[model samples]
Target: MANSPSSKKRARQAERRTEVNKARRSRIRTFLRKVEEAITGGDQAAAAEALKSAQPEVMRGVTKGVLHKNTASRKISRLSSRVKAMGA
Candidate 1:
């Protein structure tokens, strides 16, 4: 389908980028899931710690364009709030 040399190169590059982005997104989700499990298990301290580590990873995703800034911020906000509620 990509007959021109430049187009062919672009297609290859796109494939590589897709794989990288998929891995990055999956990694971010794993961090988020850890926080969620900690919260759901009612371990406030663990949830707090998990959120501490996950926040930066989520933000890193935003910086890398894997997620939007607002989405990352909302996720961090919701997770922290849940952690706080667990404390109370």
Candidate 2:
């Protein structure tokens, strides 16, 4: 219960931010899932392309504060390595 007017305003702002962050997180997951599917499907080219597209989305999640920078970097690193390994 937000009794103070300022606190109420903050609560409203938080609700809006929550919706935006949720959408961003969902979009990032969708991109990641696409990369995973491509990789698992064993199409090297498609997986590489998916990873290329997912990299920026993952980084955007970091910038938007939904994901940690290190977490995003690690995910990108692992996915890239997998994509690279698929070529071998």
Candidate 3:
């Protein structure tokens, strides 16, 4: 489908990028799942720790272009709020 040499190179680059992004997304989801499990288990300390660990990972996703800044922020906000509410 890529006729031009530059277009072929660009297509190859996109394929590589897609693979990397897919791996990053899976890793981010794993971190988020840990946080969710901790929250669901009602362990405030563990949830706090999980949140602390996950926050950076989520932010890194934004920085690395796997996720939008606002999207990551919103997820962090919601997860933190849920963790906080677990105290009640």
Candidate 4:
């Protein structure tokens, strides 16, 4: 469907970017899952640590255009709240 050379090149680039973004998203999810597992296991310290570690990764995702800033902020807020509640 890409008749123009530029369009064909763009299609190719999109395919490659899709793979990269998918991998990045998957890695972000894995980090989030670690925090979730820590929280679910009732380990406040581990959950806090995981949240700390995940914060930068999530923010980096936003900076890299892999995620929205508000979305990342919401996730961080919720996770930290859950971690805080775990201590109480």
Clashing pairs in 1: none
Report the CA-based lDDT of candidate 1 relative to the real structure: 0.94
Q: Give the TM-score ranking, best first.
A: 2, 4, 1, 3
Writing each residue's lDDT as its tens digit, candidate 4 over 1-88 gives 8999999999999999999999999999999999999999989999999999999999999998999999999999999999999978
Candidate 3: worst 10 consecutive residues by lDDT?
36-45
What lDDT, from 0 to 1, does candidate 4 have?
A: 0.95
List the global CA lDDT of all models. Answer: 0.94, 0.96, 0.96, 0.95
State which candidate, 1 or 2, has the greater lDDT.
2
Better of 2 and 4 by lDDT: 2
Candidate 3 local lDDT, 1-88, one digit each (tens): 9999999999999999999999999999999999999998989999999999999999999999999999999999999999999999
Which 10-residue span in candidate 1 carries the lowest summed lDDT? 79-88
- lDDT for each residue of candidate 2 in 1-88, tens digit (9 for 90 to 100): 9999999999999999999999999999999999999999999999999999999999999999999999999999999999999989
User: What stretches of model 4 exceed 4 Å from their correct place?
Assistant: none
What TM-score goes with each of the models? Answer: 0.97, 0.98, 0.96, 0.97
Model 4: what TM-score?
Answer: 0.97
State residue 78's C-alpha deviation in candidate 3, in Å.
0.6
Q: Best to worst by lDDT, what's the order? A: 3, 2, 4, 1
